[model samples]
Target: MLHVRAVCPAEHTAEVVELLREHPGAAHLVLHRGAAVSPEGDLVEADVAREAADEIVDGLCGLGLDRTGGITLEALDTAVSDAADAAEEAAPGEAADAVVWQELLGRTGEESRVNATFLGFLAIACLLAAVGVLTDSPVTVVGAMVVGPEFGPLAAIAVGLVLHRGDLVRRAGLALLVGFPVAMAVTLAGVLAGSAAGIFDPGTIDGNHDVDFVYQVGPASFVVALLAGAAGMLAMTSAKSAALVGVFISVTTVPAAGYVVVAAVAGRWDRAGFSLLQLVVNLAGIVLAAAIVLIVRWRRQRSAPLLRPLSRG
Candidate 1:
């Protein structure tokens, strides 16, 4: 549910109330008339909770009340009043706002700034993973997993496909293309610096044939990427972010990228190829998974009707 706070002219209170009364999903309508120091000094304020916030806003806009004042909607954790529900039950109009293509596209743009940070984090994560690989410590590797930030671009890509926004598609693609190479280059520089300090020995990386965890890349990795991508998308779109942490751990982009850096420093061409393959596979999986999610969301929106009239006796 969402909490909506609207400030309108005092004269428009009856129209706003009538509109709220018509919405079946809105509850807890509180009207503050002759409010002092409001949006305008003489504006009235209405506080309400509605199941379909987007729809309610749309209806209110349609009634020309927006010209008189502004409305703000915020999501609330608590329940609202029964009278609000009764009002929605009695109202007539659309059930919800039809999915707005431009809005989804705009969201993708907003997501890019977040992706830039994720990319920088990915570089740092690879450094951590390299440390873990050097020490053969699972705990450090897990830390790297938690720190990696590739999920943001992955989620953005998914949202782009769902919304069919070309702008989003372009932005997401740009982030991925620029982010990975920059991260890889930074990791490579870190490896060179570590070697000069004698903290990292390219010799150890070259000699460690037993470290199967760092050397091999295969179809299994690609499959994991695909699954992780889907899970990441679901986590972002749904209200369940807490679960995405596990998905980050399950994928190998950060770990593998770290290994690639180590291999480059050690001159282990074979291992570098393998690690690069892992990165490619993981990225592909994420993109494909996101595309699938968008398709589903688009289809669902297409199938739903816009408005249904209420019976008037």
Candidate 2:
């Protein structure tokens, strides 16, 4: 379920109220006439089912409430009302399986930002992966996978492609293009510094370590990436947060980038080239699979009878 709050212009308040009040997937409708001071309009609130979120939000946007006024939708962790249950039951699909488009947009919009935090996490993940590769620690490599934040932007890019949002695609693409190189550069500097500091000798690495999988590209790499991408996209769209951890650890993007840096520092161009190819393959597979998933879901949702053109009257 979701909690919807909207500030609607005075003239549109009645129609908006009517729209929500008549919807089968909406419950506990509350209207406070002339309540908004900043936007200067009536405030309306309601509890809506997950399956109907896209429809309802689209209706609101069609009426220009998102631009002229304001609309806010928030997920409800626990709705203890029978009306809420009825709303969910009245909706077409199961709540757990619902793909809330607005939710995806909002989540990806924030995630695709190339901010310091995003860069910092990517750098930290790559650095950890470098250490994991040097020490041949599978556990540390997996930890780096979990710490990597690349999935968000990758998913964002897929979402943008499916939704035809060029801005989103551009922003996410920029994040990846800038993020990977910067993270690799940071890892490279760290690896070189560690070698010079006598902490770890790059010349000692023989490329026969268990962590060699990080740079070993094969059909299995693409296959695993595809599976991980599909699962990750499903987890994001269906709000299955617990499934995301599994998805994250299943891909080798960060570890491959880490190995590329370490291999380059060790003067092993062959290993570095292979690791770079692994990274590209993983990225391409994940994005391709994730985009396909979104396209399928978006098409299915668009065909649902519950979504119809909004009427101002």
Candidate 3:
């Protein structure tokens, strides 16, 4: 279930109440008239089932509430009310299967930000993977994968393409187009510095059979990425953080980037080239697979609001 808080103008409060009253999934509606200070409007709140969130959010936005006021959604971590249970039952689909497009777009928009924190996470992930690659440590490589934030932007790109939003697509693209190269550069610098300090032997990366899969691009790499992509999008839409970590660990994207760093430092262009190819293939596969998953989900839900979030005009 989701807790929806919408600030409605006094004139729209009655209409909003009527809309909520008529909707089966909108349970326990509360209207505090003339209570909003920031927006100076009536505060309307409700407990809405996940399956019905799209419709309710769209209805609220269609009434021009988003422009004049605002609406916010928060997950009900634990809902003990019988009303919530009945609301979920009355909704059209299962809560787990529902795709709240507005919430998803909002989430992806944040993930697409190419900010300092985003770059720092990516760079640290690459550096960790460099250690794993050079030391031939599978455990370290998996740890690196879990630390990588690359999936966030990849999922954002998929969401953008699915929604046909140019702004989101561009933002997410910029994150990837710049994030990977910057992370690789940072990882390389770290590796060179480590070599100078006798802390790492970059030349050992060539014969490290344990982590060789990072540079080896075969059918399995693409297949795993495709599967991970689908899972990642599913996790993103459902906001399942645990499943998302699994998706991250299933991909070779970060490990490939780390491999590229170490291999290049060793002057093994052949290994570096393959690792780069691996990186490209993994990234492309995830984007392609995730886009397909989202597109299919959108198409299958014929009742879902199409571009309702984009109906600002």
Best by TM-score: 3
Q: Across residues 182-290, which tens digit of lDDT does each residue of candidate 2 receive?
A: 9999998999899999998776658547887888899999999999999999999999989999988998899999998988888999999999999999999999999
Clashing pairs in 2: none
Say which prediction, candidate 2 or candidate 3, comes out ahead on lDDT: 2
Worst 10 residues of 2 by lDDT: 304-313
User: Tens digits of per-residue lDDT for model 3 on 160-197?
Assistant: 88788878889889999899999999998899999999
The alpha-carbon deviation from the true structure for residue 89 of candidate 3, after best TM-score superposition, in angstroms, is 1.2
Off by over 4 Å in 2: 304-313
**Deviation of model 1 at 299, angstroms:** 2.6
Top candidate, metric lDDT: 2
Instruction: State residue 161's C-alpha deviation in candidate 2, in Å.
Output: 1.1
Question: Which stretches of model 3 miss by more than 4 angstroms?
Answer: 310-313
Cα RMSD, each candidate: 7.0, 3.2, 1.7
Whole-model lDDT for model 2 versus the true structure?
Answer: 0.89
lDDT of 1: 0.65
> Which residue pairs collide, candidate 3?
none
